[model samples]
Target: MEIVTTIRREVLTLPAAHLGPDNPLPPLRPLDETHRVEDRDKEDLPRDMARQIDYAPLHSLLPVRVRDGYDRRREPRPIDTLVIENDRLRVTVLPGLGGRIGSLVHRPTGRELLYRNPVFQPANFALNGAWFSGGIEWNIGATGHTALSCSPVHAARVPAPDGGRMLRLWEWERLRDLPFQVDLWLPEGSDFLYVGVRIRNPHEKPVPTYWWSNIAVPEDCRVLAPAEEAWQFGYERRLRRVPVPVHDGTDRTYPRNSTYAADYFYEVPERRRRWIAALDADGRGLVQTSTDELGGRKLFVWGRGPGGRRWQEWLTEPGTGGYCEIQAGLARTQLEHVRLEAGGEVSWMEAYGPFDARPDGEWTGVLRAAEDRLEAVLPRADVDAARTAWQPYADTEPGERLATGSGWGALEVLRAGWKLPGTPFDESTLGEEQQPWLHLLRAGSLPEPPDSRPPGGTLVARHWRDQLETAPATPLTEYHLGVAQWHAGDRAQAVRSWERGLRHAPVRWPVLRCLAVADQEARHPERAAERYAQAFDDLGRVRREAGDDDGSWTAVTAALGREAVEALLAVGRTGDARSVWQRLDPATRERGRFRLIEAGLLLAEGRREEARAVFDAGFEVADLREGDEVIGRLWGALTDEPLPEHHDFRMRPTP
Candidate 1:
């Protein structure tokens, strides 16, 4: 089949006569095709949003020529080199400058290109650097000044004693070359870059070194990765950190959005390699992975700033510049060393492509299979424990402060909202946060709830109250009673129950969360903020003492804090919101998605077009597919839409 693709600068279009090894430039081999279509609206999006949507096509781009050259002049004045050719592409070699390519020149198959390469300045960091060689202007001195110099490092391959062998290929050349050539074939309009490093251990005493690529991804893009869990440890102390409970007692009002700063550094115990995907402005997404040579580098799915929430968790932008990096020769800054042999070599491998929803399953499937295979080969004790820790619970005692319920186990009776058996979330009250379920009860508004009088309502209430009244009461039981009353629509009564519960158990995060959520929904965000702040502080203390590493819970607490703060903002509590955000770690504050969503909410409340812009911006930063579980969650919060289908909302096993 004929492949229609964009040739940015056809790497090789030389006649068959130029195919020999003696040729100075290597023939471009077949790289993958670009699948994007110019128009997407005409495409039929899958009815199932969970289904990956394929909106465009990818045209395979290939390399047609290959060549290599070395500077022949001797070392008295360390040799520097330049290439001048009328061919499809040109190459220049600068020795000892650093691990980076000294110079490169690419000329379109039929055009004369005379573009100069951008200079590299350390102060002005750059994610990538490139040059156009054929028809562009030339000035070596100027190029040197502008071009950033990578640290001088030795590569595996060094020039031969004789000049015939023009280039010294690094051991990792085989791995890097293919992807490098492939990236050049990316469709127009999408922005991407590939950087390769050659780590050469010159000393007999091997010392561990870390390699990092500061990929300059688009400012507004979402990142996707499949990891067991994420960390919330902040690199800096002042940076906001999530406050998860190390032992017990967490607030209920905290919102639980996925993305945050605080430096998420994760290591997959079962699998060494990981992959990350990102969607750009044009609805295009890319997936990148680490190669075996790197022996499975830990995946770092990170982006920071108040705008960070939008970029890392679920944001999406097809044409933006977010990137997935493959660092082969290093480990995280403070981890164990990967000892290399005397003649050792370290290489990293990764792959990326446009974000097509349909292909995502296949792409993710491959990673899972690979991870499974790795796990099978390398049995890890930590992996099992981590999995166990993340497992969902099946049942809790009557008075237990339930973090989550199975299906609608807790909401079997709908005093004011409709419930499908076993599903506690309301069919009619779909778009509100979990806090609203309890708030509705406290407000004495159960008349409209479906199944409000489920058979065991009175018994359950009595059971909860009994637990709360027990001497040395379980704060958990009181917390649940407060929830039940709130749902019963007796706002004052619910508060009384919570206040009583707090008196019995003040440090319970759930109690604080429930009360704060109630207050916020009741239009008193200031009071809610205070409670949330206190709950978070207490929770943070627990995490620090226990040395908790997982950030999911901390993220959950932060979400609650943000929710109350956002609510306060809505009620003209800008000062309160500002104060809450100010206390947040710089990373949390910089989460773009959360900020944009907050801004969107503010705009929506104000009835402005900026709300739409904020929504679009939020979408760009979200890692959403056509259909995702989160879509249901968002719909429930944004609109009073019922779930399209019912799944047991039961708080069964998490897996």
Candidate 2:
């Protein structure tokens, strides 16, 4: 069969020659041994419980990628690029790269609706690290780039019921042990694309999962949504309610005035139809809307500052100014906030297309006009007709089923029974493990203590102490004991326990992390810095040995190294802090928190001109008091004046 290559609308697959061994995608790291459990029967459990409960291995773990010594010279390589188009809209998908929509073009205007990266560049960004920025990335399973991102998936071209064509991408996520598929349908004469997603748990056991479709558009675009309130986590990690569209009397829809990067998750008003759009000044932009099938619309803005600009460079090639993400999810917020049940499945359909603003209209008016246009573009008949034709594709059998069409084999067309997404299912939520303390102890890698309901921190610490006295000091037991001691206000004892654990289990990253925190709290900056640095090194060694090098582990180590820098700065070790800052990846330093630290270091070195330049590059200092103190100290350091007595120049970096 001859492959069609034309401007006419069609779905065609092309080979991706850019991916190879020298620049291979990051591999998924296995669950940490502390969290791994062979079986509950192997532990000293009650006889009745041991006989009745069958504990399956918690295989669906957090996805971690290790990126140490990664090759940055790799060019973009897509396994297969599927192009679907109509006269007004054209979309390109890279099935191998997490089935991401590589590019979407408004054909009539010849403008790209999505931020199309010239290359497939994976960076240490997502929660799991190794996230590619441009285009639309499908995040399934855990919150970060789903385990499938940067991995190949099953793809096929199927006939659309509307006499057009559809491209299907399906993958079995090993970690979640669930199957998910996304079908991109382009009808014969439609200007918009219909996206149908289905996630099913084929196992008898219940699974927890998340589904988020992330759409990237131009950074400076204004976001218009039907929301009056939003949910955001503050610097202290506390969730707070704030006004949507505007916060603190400032419109958040536009990025120009913001001083800091922020993520706003909105509780979209309950309505039959919900929509969100990112539009340029001319009113030409991308719009996304869905039926009640999906909820939780969000806007992730990266401010147009030095840190944001540096991140854009890190995420993509130069000249493609940073882009903002308009995300839609299935749950209230992120993945950890929701779960899926056994034999249960969730399905949803969403529409994406281009819209033009009304002439001489303000942003609010333009938004209302866009909504009116969307209502007309996405009618009930069109949605129902597409759903009627696409139901069979989503209702396929669990695994290895024959997908009859287009001369494709069963294996080539349908793949199923992959891992489910998200963290391990809480056993306490099960029938047998009802004891709260027992569940906590088991999850923490500790044996059931004498008192299942240890009411207070003191009691918990005593129980852990008794267990340590009776049993050998293994890394897990020591770490748990240290946590209990810390909770009981025995910081010194906790430090000792962590130190002892490190001596016995020298490579335990968790123990080192605990020790570092304890040192920091105890005002031992030097010791804290040392412990953090050691932990960073230990994580790197483990990643190398496991051959799981990617951004996930790199993110952890980079964070630890940043903590070390902060500790060094606290003790006035400017030279050491500068050395550590310089050693960080340029991309990591480009983050807002690190940029501030870099400027402080330059100020400490008496390079006033360089420090001023860094400050002028746009720093998102949210706390006015802290910002003032830092500035005051820099001034005092340069001059011979004494610094203010109450001012604390050292500040913890915000993520």
Candidate 3:
């Protein structure tokens, strides 16, 4: 079974919840950027640091819709999994979940090298919402997590460098508009698994690209990387350069040594061989090394604090051990994106395997011994040579299709006539979501949904926006134009387009909602609230007249209703907010998110007892963001009662 790859499907019957259909509303504005770092905290900085970490140019999650329609009701669901293994190592890949490496086992010792989660619990971690922890997650696109974290990516069987086969996963990352591939293979008798990654920019201009292969390692291990100084980013969104091994009187190399969660990105010099290791007391754990192009190495630890511990439990099952992340990326830090020039591509090789080093002692000695042992086992020269040997096979066409991903990539490729040699987004993969856009591309007009359904997703890519600009100007076109313009940071034009569309729009709620978002961003909270109210009322009327039997309109209307109530509450319109909440469908109000909203409303009205009761009745918010303080604040608002154990997800030191 040396290096041979055959694709077969198996069901991982974990107690996992479902990622239901995405929210229908478009994410018009950019999310608050988490890459907040002050200049005073830096030591040695890159010359182009300002441009790399500045606000994102393409910020909206358009065409690629938000995946926020999941809940916490766990069932014995069967997850789609694909396996690729050789004699020494057996690897399981979750193609349907961002091509995540679900498990990597060392057959000789029967050890799981990476942290494998016992359950598949979806949380509000991914950029688009639903994300599960554990395994190796491929993060591509902007800062924060990838929009494709819980989504599928195309997978296939491809030839390896040694005339054997390897598993290849490829997808068109919509956020940055770049196509990338990840190829995984294990050699005949090799202990390490080789991963070849490539990102291509087919456009005529440069695109800022971010790629991080995040490996989850057991928290019992001490993380070591070859750097004396590290840039640390905390939940405060502040970045500071601190000494490695020890910082703030804590030996920072150990995962649980700190009291709060943070990221330590090693500042590896240009000449140093790139590698990071998480080794236990006996110095045996996972070690990751890569060729030159993949220059970045980072260690992310969920500290031993209550919030950190709660987060650890949140992502997995009870009585399970926690894990930290040792990641490799294309930049010095996860906060920055490397430049991929037009018509250019960046490719590199990475190897992951079990490492045995000298026993733990002084940090410096342990790191040196670990580095020496890694070199002895899988030399730096061998990594580079393997990359050189793998370049030819990187362009080898995929042999057999094992799984399919989103059709957005196929739409882009078909529109641009791009010749991506190895990663083919075949036309057959195009589904209903892409059909309207396909019609728009071919017929020069995007059509309205059948049977007066709500508007579908909008495309905000430059090419698509240009197409929208040229297409005939109807209410539908104008509404879509507004979405495209809004996504590109053209607020004034987007508003003008939406207002124009409203003049004759038979379906005015979508346009009105866009205007509401624009008003909210422009600081006209009152106007935003009014527009939201109007939008919600219009949508409610549509649902009533249409007599929705399938509850589809109810969900969409309920989503809009939540936004409307929040907008009303922002301006202290408690009564108005209550009215909006009261109008929501009864079943929708029972959701975890809505229940929290219910508590917020009661708290706002000084009904502390009712709010406390809402908390007393245990509820798990499916979309509770990492570092979210709402639950804590609400618990405090219902002051005099103890904060519930389920609600204490604080990751920062209390003020």
Name the candidate that leads on TM-score: 3
TM-score of each: 0.27, 0.58, 0.97
Error of 3 at 512 (Å): 1.0
Best lDDT among the predictions, by candidate number: 3
Model 1 C-alpha lDDT per residue in residues 94-173, reported as the tens digit of each score: 32232233333333433111111222211111111111111111111110111212211122221111211112211111
Instruction: Give all candidates' CA lDDT scores.
Output: 0.32, 0.58, 0.86
Which parts of model 3 have CA positions greater than 4 angstroms off?
1-7, 39-51, 55-58, 640-642
Rank by TM-score (best first): 3, 2, 1
State model 3's lDDT. 0.86
Span of ten consecutive residues with least summed lDDT in model 2: 404-413
Candidate ordering by lDDT (highest first): 3, 2, 1
TM-score of 3: 0.97
The C-alpha RMSD of each candidate to the native structure, in angstroms, is 27.7, 13.6, 1.8
Deviation in Å, model 3, residue 162 alpha carbon: 0.9
lDDT of 3 by residue, 483-553 (tens): 98988878899999999999999888999999999998999999999999899888888888888888878
> Higher-lDDT candidate among 2 and 3?
3
Error of 1 at 179 (Å): 22
